[model samples]
Target: MNSLKRIMVGLDLSEMDDTLIRYTAFLCSISEIESVYFIHAEKSLDIPQEVLESMPTGMPADEKLRTSLIEKVEHYFGPDSRTQVEVLVVEGSPLKELLNLSKVNHIDLVVVGRKFHMRGSGLLAQKILRNGRVSVLFVPENEEPKLDHIVVSVDFSDYSLMALERMLTSALTKPNVRITCLHAYQVPSGYITLGMNYEDFDKRMQGFAHNKFAQVLERFPSLDGRATLHLVKQENEDDMGELLVVEAKRLKADLLVIGAKGLSAAALFVLGSVTEKMLRYNDDIPMIVYRKENEEIGFLDALLGND
Candidate 1:
């Protein structure tokens, strides 16, 4: 949690934009976040020459518009505030500017609003999740920022384990917060062809799942009493993401935390399939997608051995 010192919040000036800002503010109030930046990326405004000529003599229309947007964002925070806030307006592609800003400022988290029904915002969110290196938290429209119930998806990979550790650390700071670590798995189709009884096969699979859960707990003894484990079985060997969404809904989880990628090297550029599907299928719960920081390798180590 100490790594999350600076936070960047994306603002589209839509009605839902305030929700993102308020939610980030709430997080700052609870966590050790030092500063928050509210940034708006202004895409093409397409103004004709005639309209420019009729504008005020001193300030241009675009400049005035940017100023107004900044003012509106500042107004949201008002005079009384516990955390330092800054507003910025940049002219370029939203995703591009946001990613650049995150890299330049070393942002720990990027907060943005997601509208399930809107195509433009949804695509923008997906792009951010795929391309941005910083951790992201997508808040749904009108959803309150609460940490009462949290669910972290685990698959025993380094990425998922990092995500679970981060979530557990954050939850430990809050009062009355409950955490559930969920693992969704499927049995291989070839097992059915081995002439095994269906009931016995199911029982064996369940036992295997329980054993793996125990191993996970043994690895992180800090989570022994602080978290609960939930195992989900998928008969089809697919739709792991869909099952996660269903479980989250059934548990009435307030937040869902997951890793940005999994154990595959193919996930270097884009998100893992399960993470992508969860983003597309669930529109009600807010999700936090975390990426573990890469460890720096020395020059000699890089040349002589795999680091």
Candidate 2:
């Protein structure tokens, strides 16, 4: 999770590809990435007879697409870039192709477009987020190429710690980058059963949360300037995820990172509830959903069988 050697950028034939290309190049310039693959999946490489007859280029659909993507990479990624780039044009279901290619190529990260104020339905991003085992970076259409501030949602769980470890060991661990572990807690109604008043229990809850954060921070000296922000869930605050998105925006965070609790899509990959909730409410900020990729994905076989 720390050393991201290779990555795959999912490209759709849209304006969003321009943004993804630039952002991915910016990432390679900063990180120690060795290889990058720009992949686009088409339902079919066959063009209708009428369509082929009216086309500007006589090349096959797949070859033309590959040339266009390569040109885009050369334009934004630059010819002198250190990273080795490849263009893959696959024919099949987009989701199936992307998932299979990533596994076959041993990709460390999957970069996909998170359409906001764009033409896409954002369905591909969600499907990739839910089904892929590798880490995913969801870049919105208008997202800038930056990684200054990273906000990680924490509940003092191992899943949250896994995410924080990634940031600490990631290439963005430079002095300029800032990482904040945000935690949201609620004062239980049972606190009153312990013979403490509402105000007394509230202060106690805050104290407990601070102690936990201190312990967690003590384990990582690299996070010296790192701090925690605690939010008390109000009676009517139905979604904690909304609060996290709000605070991250308030801090002008460039990326949101979280660890999904389990490997199953039903368990919420790259989400751990934070991303699961914000997927509905968030529109602008990019998010990095970290999850453990199982060695073998039976679910993928099911998806492929659906074809």
Candidate 3:
């Protein structure tokens, strides 16, 4: 009901079947959401025209399923709620349909339910992260959402800046928000590392990282210097993924934001060791991953299927 005009939630029959609906309604009430959409996508093989004709609305049974989904969603949120509830059943690709709905409906935030392993499904999540325009909040099955401290994994890249901007925009209404801006840089070592003094390298890198963070802070002057700045230099090893989780847990951050492409499985393998390995398996902390515009997403090709 605040300024988050549209929130699109992806609902499916899974372990956390109702998690997205509950979370969406809760956020809608707090954000002053105008309308709430519960979209369910069904993957099907081929169907004869006769079957389609016999179905309600001359559509697939999936389309008829909208009625039940609507009832279930409303039951959770209750009929007394002010937010208008709309249920849609689209017969096609899941992510593609969701993205189109978001664009057409002017969705502000996209809520997705994330399940462990499931092979191909993880790829679907990756595709949504890569292709969708809305900010994606990946909620694990059965895990409650939290908003205590936000951990930002910053690489001082333009992509990271985009994620930071999202964080600032989403966090303003929060009365007390603790932000940890983390940067991990390599400190040259070994014989080549010995050629350059590690101390001086550490000093310059720390100053540079700190300065970049300061620039980001300036961008959001309203933050009023409440954020905690962190600069981490890797002398012995460089494991971005492991370090981020370790530090986040150490700081007890409730939310985490990181650029999507930066943490791609391929990028992690080539760029260096990354935190993605941990993220892929761990769902303890809810993560908001931002995929920038113009990024190619072959991984998400399945999500755009037949749409």
Candidate 4:
């Protein structure tokens, strides 16, 4: 899983910025954060000719935007910050700028707001989660920044395993934080070929799931006391995401985590179907699309030129 050291928080200068800033500060206080960047992205920083004609001083638009955001960060990022903080206002698509900045800065994690009643796009969030090599955390407007209980979506895939193991580390999990490994399983429709009835097939699926869960526990014997597995049967054909979200809410999870699957070499991003569903259905519970960073390097990924 991608580490959480240098974090980049996306700010849009909206009400959500308040929550995002405080939440990031809360994270910085808890984790071993080396640096944090509060960035606001715009399509263009050029002031209109009519607007510029009335201005007395000729400060650049990006500089003005940066100054405004820095003031806000200072006022709300708390008084005892120990980590390095930088404010940036860039010109580009908000999503693309965030992706490019992540690569350019060697950023480990990207935190952004997950609006509920406010306007938001699951598709855009999906793209950011899939395109960026770094992990992405979605913070709801009203969700508290505390990391008390983390509910991890586990399907026994490598990605799922990576997410769970990373969540147990000191970066995100405190000594007293509770951990839940949530698994949702469903019986295949082809059970009739095996001469088994629906009820028996269901029981078989449950048993197989438990067996897999046991093997997983063997790998992480330390999880004996640290984590608990909550299993649910997926009833509908396309209900894995909704089921996970409902269970997470019922368990009063503060944070939800799932491993990310990026673009494959031969084709486009293998945006896991269930993950895409969860992003669309989830309205609360801060979620982390955690994945190990890609090894590929390019022009933007070569160096952190910003000092």
Candidate 5:
């Protein structure tokens, strides 16, 4: 229902690569995905001119490595998979190639793995989070995706609403999936400087959060008794991203959903601060970064009010 027909998965030939493939396969089983492209970008390394000249250009070392990697990936999937799979081995920067492939193929979702070390996949994941145009799912190592308890971050913005809509549509397809809408708010610094009681300020903020939650729920009548709303008060020194990670761990959430951008105007096609921070802090839970739809504006409309 969310229109995820084509998914591109970046493979780094690590142990986590299998986990990512299995997760994508699971998603394909549930959704109507038509194709899954498993791609590996072989980084070009410096070599002596004589050594390069000695090797034939017909089939380079990278091409051989790519062929081997494709064979390995195919062995993992075996021949029984119902989904159509394609394996590609390209030579370039992994992040740049992945972004370009997604755009060229009109991919709906891009799946990649995240590791604890910041060497290969971890660094690539960070770049994708910041620059990728399409939706991305960062699957953690050694974790089977259950998607049982999902925590979606909301700020009542259009991007956040897009996340909520995607989550609801996906959740409706899964059985016994628990959805929690989390909103983290902080009192204005001015209020604290004004000598307002912390307790009173917290109470007022809680009331406001409750009203906002109600209004959000009013927009989606179908989620009346299905999803639960959670409000968290942010401490002066606490980061909203860290708070979200803590809450997700407490909820034992298998998946976390967040908008790619925030309410800020500058966040048009970039990762919002909170989303970026969360990816940096947490490496265990998988996350889905949902992007808002593109609405085209004409040149005349941009210059004047109407044509």
Candidate 6:
């Protein structure tokens, strides 16, 4: 909603298993989107005599596949969304091209499908969090794409506060809309040199977390009666992503909003391991990743989730 004039979406040809793209188009159609960019990034292959010698079979060039994928997106979204559509087919990494196109096109939001769950803490998610320049939404595979109950995960950072405010302004249209402010906690994994009691440490930590939650509530006037707060004590049993997904599912939340750091050097080397894993989750729960900036953070909650 945030006066979004341009929107960009990254698509993979093989993962056309659902109506995510169409759903996105529909959402855009209802908004004030001036244009939409559908991008497909493909891998290239150069046939070498030595490599040909090793090949058991020959395959077609990757560009053809890329074009075909772009065509399919055009076919699906073109007739329905009716908004201006620009298609780009590029070689090399999807993430890189996606980011480049965002800059070149002056896009405000980049919508992508998350095929799997991200693993271990990585810098890629961090960088995306910090430098992506634009807001990014990672849509999950489950939970029918609708806007309804939305849970905003908060760490009480400046960026996260912006995210919460944006969600409140953009995504909720109906009077019955509900927003839950979730803060997660977990015990650290390490050795203590001091002889301090473990129970005392936990008690103090819990108290600090509660105080932080209260402070978050007091900081935002937009959240007054529109949002309720919930504190989640992450058992040593679950990772951050899992804990988030579980709570969203339990609430039958239509959308889950979380702030991401984007990607780091190490995360890039892994080639979509972190974000892709989060995408691969078979659930229909859709999510949007937002950059921590004043301009990018408003009305994002609606676009981040379905109502």
For model 6, residues 1-307, the per-residue Cα lDDT tens digits are 4546777877654353235477666566546567888776655454344533433344454445445555666766656565788776677655566666888988767776555443322223223333466777666543245775788878787656776766655533344767887777765644254555666666666787778877877876656677777767777766556676677677777777765443444333332442334434425676766654434433432332221
Tell me the deviation in Å of residue 173 in model 4. 1.0
Clashes of each: 0, 0, 7, 1, 0, 38
* lDDT, residue 126, candidate 6: 29
**What is the TM-score of candidate 5?**
0.81
Off by over 4 Å in 1: 45-80, 117-120, 171-175, 192-195, 262-265, 268-272, 295-307
Compare the candidates by TM-score and give the number of the best one. 2
Q: Candidate 3 has what TM-score?
A: 0.77
Candidate 5 local distance difference test against the native: 0.74
lDDT of 1 by residue, 162-239 (tens): 887776565223646777888786666667698887777777877887787788789877667777878788868557
Cα lDDT computed for each candidate against the true fold: 0.73, 0.78, 0.67, 0.78, 0.74, 0.60
Q: Higher lDDT: candidate 3 or 5?
A: 5
TM-score, per-candidate, Cα-based: 0.82, 0.89, 0.77, 0.85, 0.81, 0.64
Question: On residues 79-165, what C-alpha lDDT tens digit does candidate 4 reach at each position?
Answer: 677888999988877777888888899887888888776655434555576556778888887767788898999999888988887
Model 2 gets an lDDT of 0.78
Output the better candidate (2/4) by TM-score: 2
Preferred candidate (TM-score higher): 1 or 5: 1
Model 4 clashing-pair count: 1
Ranking of all candidate structures by their TM-score, best first: 2, 4, 1, 5, 3, 6
**Over the stretch 154-244, how does candidate 2's per-residue lDDT look in tens digits?**
7888878877777676686677887777777777889867999988988887888788888887888778775555454545456777887
